[model samples]
Target: MKKKCISGLVMLLCVMLVSTSVLFAAGSKESGASNEVDKIKSRGVLNVGVKVDVPGFGYKDISTGANVGFETDLARQIAKVILGDASKVSFTPVTAKTRGPLLDTGELDIVIATFTVTEERKLSYEFSTIYYTDAVSLLVKKSGGYKSLKDLDGKTIGVAQSATTKAVLETEAKNQGITLKFSEYASYPELKVALDSGRIDSFSVDRAILMGYVEDSSEILPDKYSPQEYGAAMKKGNLALLSVVNSTIADLDASGELLAMKAKWGLDK
Candidate 1:
């Protein structure tokens, strides 16, 4: 009888150990699944990716030495929603080529760098509701005498590398029966310099971005092409974070803050 009781006690101990281990494993998975938003809250800071060169959208103000643009404002607004304070945000300047990868690698909590939403990108990242709409257009020297897409035939246009603008321009050119040469630059500033130096006949990008570089000698084509909706982007599978972002954007729209931001950044025009 004594031997039997000792064996039963040992069996119970083994079962309890196994049950505890199983519970721990399950809890770890649940923790991992919801950790993104929780991590941000614990840190009390939101890391936002933005462009430093696009003037009205996300650029560094020379006077304040701080980023000031529509996207910048949106990032701050998101920080407010997440952390209860708009100032609890850090901005990282990212280029078109680097934005997606940085977001993937956890270097950024969210990206608001005029990132356009597309079907292809949806596979890799989650996008918030469309916050802004922009159209692709051309910027050329007024003296270049390029009136329309047809005039771009055999001319070189400068575009940022890894951007959708080049592909959009190619499609439009094909429809117009124009054959164009494209010069790729790493950033908008490089493309702007190429256009100014006459290395390229024109620079192509979102009209709102090109508007920042427009000068007395430069002109934006009157006709806009290829409308795109801009959204904030984050790593895929973060439903909680996405929900927060979508809700914030909805609130901004409902409260007319989005429209006010557009006007403040010169996008309302």
Candidate 2:
């Protein structure tokens, strides 16, 4: 009877051990999730992806080497609201081809470059409500006498390869029954050079970008171009992040910060 009692006690201890292990495992998972939440709350830093080249929309100032433009300013503002330190932002230069992949890989917390919102893009990413509005516009040398998109027919137009501009132009051309020779450049700077040297008669982008470039460069403005607005892009299912972004943007717009930013950036007519 003593031996039997010993065996029963041993079994009870084994059961208790297994039960305790299971409880600990469940607790660990909850703890991990809680830790993730805590990390975000504590870190207070936002990793942002922005274009290092697109002037007035996203670009590094040549003199200051500081990131400036509408998107850059907006990114700083969003970071201020979310992280409480606009200066706590880490900006990574993202090109059109790499922005999506970088965001998907979790390398970027947000992308605030001049990314356009589209239904197809929505499948992979979310977009805040239209933060800025824009229509396609042109950049022409003062001596070129080109005033609008209509002036580019049959002319070699410089465009950043793999951009929305080419398609927008093609669609507009088709609708207007016109033809244009497209000269593709790998980057915006190259396209700008091509336009200045007369290798292409015009360069196109959202009007705001064109105007910003013109405002800063005598080689490029009033006689050179015009602008429009574009929306902010974010990752899909990142509803928490998107919510914060939308709120910040709405606040900026309602308070006139958005309009004021554009005006300060030379996008004002």
Candidate 3:
């Protein structure tokens, strides 16, 4: 009888020990997550990924050596909304190919680069409400007289490989019966330089990007450019974070803070 009682006590102790261990493990996980949150909150900093090469939108200022552009200002605004200090943001320059992986691996908290919103991208990353809208525009030399996609038949048109813009352009070109000789590159820098050097007849990208180049260039084509909308990118399933971002965007829109900021950055033009 004493042996039975001893065994029963041992079993109860074992069960209690197991329960305590499990509780500790779960508590540790929660604690770790809470610590991460607190770290971000305490520092009032948000790490945002942005494009470095795109001029007038995400370029480094030649004089001050600071990142200045429309998207940069927008990122700063987002940081101010979440962290209470627009200057608290740390910028991480990422290319189009690296943005998704960096955000996926937790290297970037938000992507405020020239990211376009699309149905296919909705499957992977979460996008904040559209902030700026433009269309996909084709830039050609003034001498080329390439007015539309229909004019690009058998001509080399530069585009970025793996870019959503490329796919959209290709689809539209196909639908419109425009046959283009695609010259693919990994980054916009390559494509733009190629276009400027007359390596390709034209290049297709966001209208804002083309305008940035046109504004800085001495001689650009007299052709009409198109436009597209840009959105902030974030990790999927981050409903709380996305909600906060969306709310902030709404407030900015309603208060005309967005327009004011745009004007400040010359994006309102």
Candidate 4:
């Protein structure tokens, strides 16, 4: 009888021990789990990807050595909304090809780098509503006598990799009965160099981006096509952060601050 009692007590203790361990394990997991917004808040600084080369949108100001532009300002606004301080944000310069991979690696919390929203991209990442609209345009040297895209038939045009310009222009070329050859560059500065060195007859990308590279020697051809809508992007399943971003953009637009910011950077045109 005593042995039976002892065995029963041992079983009860074992059950209690197992229950305690299960509770402890669950508690550890619950304590460790945090959503996207909580992670950003815990860090106290928002990390964003931006373009360092495109002026009026994102660029490094030489005198200040600070990034300044419409999109940079947007990042600050987003940081302020999320972290309660505008200055508590960091920028990682990203190009067309690097932005997606950076965002995929969890190195960046968000991308404010003139990311164009497309049906194809929505499959990979979550994007905010369109914050800015622009059209793909061309920049050609005046000496080339290239009056329009149609004039550049059989001529090679420079385009940025991972941008929609090349595809849109190809369709336009087909419609206009002109065949265009394209040379892809990783950056706008490189494309400009290609144009300057006679390797490419024209530089083509979003007009807002092209504006920064235009010079006394080159002019943006009066051709614009395929409206591109810019949106901020984050990895899929970051709905907590995406909700905040989308709401912040809506508030900015509703308050007319978005337009004012655009005008401040001469982007309202």
Best candidate per TM-score, number? 1
Instruction: Kindly list the per-residue Cα lDDT of model 4 for residues 196-218, writing each as its tens digit.
Output: 99999999999989998888999
Q: TM-score per candidate, in order?
A: 0.88, 0.75, 0.79, 0.87
Prediction 2 TM-score vs. true: 0.75
- Model 1 lDDT per residue over 1-269, tens place: 99999999999999999999999988876667468888999999999999999999999988889999999999999889889999999999999899999999999999999898999999999999999888999999999898987888999989888899989988988888889999999999898899999999999999999999999999998868888899999998777788899999999999998999999988998
Q: State the lDDT of candidate 3 residue by residue for 1-269, as single tens digits.
A: 99999999999999999999999998886676455445667867888899887876788887998888878888887778777888988999988788999999987878988888888888999899999886677777766766666777778878776666666666777777877777788777787789878898887777667766663342333433334567898887655567667888899899998888778666776
A best-first ranking of the candidates according to their TM-score comes to 1, 4, 3, 2
> Which residues of candidate 4, in runs, are more than 4 Å off?
1-34
- Candidate 3 versus the native: TM-score? 0.79
Least accurate 10 contiguous residues by lDDT in model 4: 26-35
| Runs off by more than 4 Å, candidate 2 | 1-43, 215-229
Candidate 4, residue 88: Cα displacement in angstroms equals 0.8
For model 2, the local distance difference test gives 0.74
Backbone clash pairs in model 2 (N, Cα, C under 3 Å; residues 3+ apart or in different chains), count: 8
lDDT (C-alpha, whole model) for all candidates: 0.91, 0.74, 0.77, 0.92
Q: How many residue pairs clash per model?
A: 0, 8, 4, 0
RMSD of 3: 5.9
Better candidate by TM-score, 1 or 3: 1
Candidates ranked, most accurate by lDDT first: 4, 1, 3, 2
